[model samples]
Target: MALAIFDLDNTLLAGDSDHAWLEFLSTLGIVDGEELRRANDRYYRDYMNGELDMGDFLRFVLAPMAAHPRRQLDAWHCQYMQERVLPMITDASRALVRKHADAGDTLLIITATNRFVTAPIAVELGVPTLLATEAECDDNGEFTGRSYGIPCFQEGKVERLRQWLGARGLPWEDSLSTAYFYSDSHNDLPLLELVGNPVAVDPDKILLATAQERGWPVLSLHGSCHPVT
Candidate 1:
């Protein structure tokens, strides 16, 4: 079967789910609101500039979950998916995923966003596989405020995905055939280049330029997801 990978943040949805999740948490009064908001804002700035430190970013993102039980977090996430994420899953996004599903592709959502933040969205899209930054948990099943594996960002995305396929005994190097990855960020360029078919979905300036240069297909799930500058 052919492979179809999708980037979660701005590609499949209308906004950055990670940022939205942080906002969701901020309103719940679970974490220190001011501290969390400031850190999130700083990290988002770093991320936009492509200067993010994955270790620090993951720790910042996962810290609130450390204080809570998995069941509680899951409950909150269910609310989050219903309230925040569901609205962002536009008809165009669902159709894009369905197109691949109908083609019998091995669909995957590979995102830099953490599994806790993006997993439900993947489920909604009906994709069977997800490769996202993993949050580490302690012996008591509480988050440890650390990452479990390589953060799937930039070139790390390529490495982590290869490791994922290799561990499954899937042929890594030869698997790009009929492989397609749809993404919207310059951060995803490494993975976009690795796949045989790279589709730019409502791309940023850099990715748009690169996709044009490489003759990659351009697609739009909807209008620009970028916020007002």
Candidate 2:
């Protein structure tokens, strides 16, 4: 079966889910509001500027929630998924996913967002596979604010994709024949180049310019109010 990989943040949703999740945690009083907000802003800046490492970013963002019970965090995650994230899934993106599903393509979400947050959204979209940053947990199910594997960002994303495909007896060459990738950032460049078709969805300026140079398809679903760059 052909593979269709989609990015989660700006490509699938209106904005960054990581930022939204942090904001949600603050609202629930699970995190220190001012500190988390400031850290999130710094992380966002560093991430866009290609300065922050994935592991560091995850630790920084999740540290505040580390003291909370795992069950409580999971409950909040479910509520956040239902209330905030679900409504943001645009009809156009849903249609794209549906078209791929109808074609019997292997739909997967490859995101830097944590799996705890993106898993429900993937299920809602009928995507069976998800490649995302995984947070480490203890035997008691408490988050360690650390990752067990490579955080799925930049080169780490490409590595995880390759590993996933390899485990399924599918190589990049085999997957690339009818493969498609949807993303919004230059950070996804490696996987974008590996796919047969690269679609830029509400891309950042760098990604848009690169896609333009390469003559890749570009799609903008949301209105002018949504930032495009």
Candidate 3:
């Protein structure tokens, strides 16, 4: 079976879960709405423009978890999933995932979002494997407001995926018939280029342009399947 790697944010879901999670917290009065919104928006814009400082962004995103008990954070996340994430999940996205699984492909969701935010979404989508930026936790199982290991953004995605494959005794080119990577952001271009089948899912302007120039398949999982050659 082939390896089907999917990006979780805009590729699989209709919106950015990390941003949505912060907005959800604002609604709950867990954070300073105006101040946090400004910073979040700036970071998001930076990310789209390929200028994000992952270290600063990670510290900002993980602070809430570090300040709260695990129980409280889990409670908030349960609500966040129901309220914010459920609406982002589209029928077409689910079908795409099911299509790959039905073909006996090994499904994996590789995202730059923190695992704390994307883990349940992976479970909800029934994808068995996920690689997300790790949120470091203290010995008591509470987040420490820091990220561990590689940030898993941009080129880091390719490095981490290589490590994952190597650990399983799998060679990059010979083990699978093909490796399919579906992504929407240009930030994932590194991993996308490394895969045999790089499909752009409702791509951003930069990614769409690159996909067209490179003759990669462009697909829309947000609605009816629109395939561009």
Best candidate according to lDDT = 3
Candidate 2 per-residue C-alpha lDDT over 1-229 given as tens digits, one digit per residue, 9 for 90 to 100: 5798999888878777888888888898777899877887887788778787676778776675577788888788889987788878887778778888888898999998888778888888778999999977888889887777888999888899989988988877878767999998888988898889998888888899999999998887555433323
Residue pairs whose backbone atoms clash in candidate 2: none
Candidate no. 1 TM-score: 0.92
Which regions of candidate 3 deviate over 4 angstroms?
A: 175-177, 225-229
Model 3: ten consecutive residues of lowest lDDT: 220-229
The local distance difference test score of each candidate is 0.84, 0.83, 0.90
lDDT of 1: 0.84
* lDDT tens digits, residue span 58-167, model 3: 99988888988999999999999999999999888888899899989999999889999999999999999999999999899999989999988899998888889999
Each prediction's TM-score against the native? 0.92, 0.93, 0.96
Rank list by lDDT: 3, 1, 2
Tens digits of per-residue lDDT for model 1, 155-215: 9889888988899899976787679999998888888888898999988888999999989
Clashes of 2: 0
- All candidates in order of TM-score, best leading: 3, 2, 1
Enumerate residue pairs that collide in model 1.
Answer: none
lDDT of 2 at 212: 96
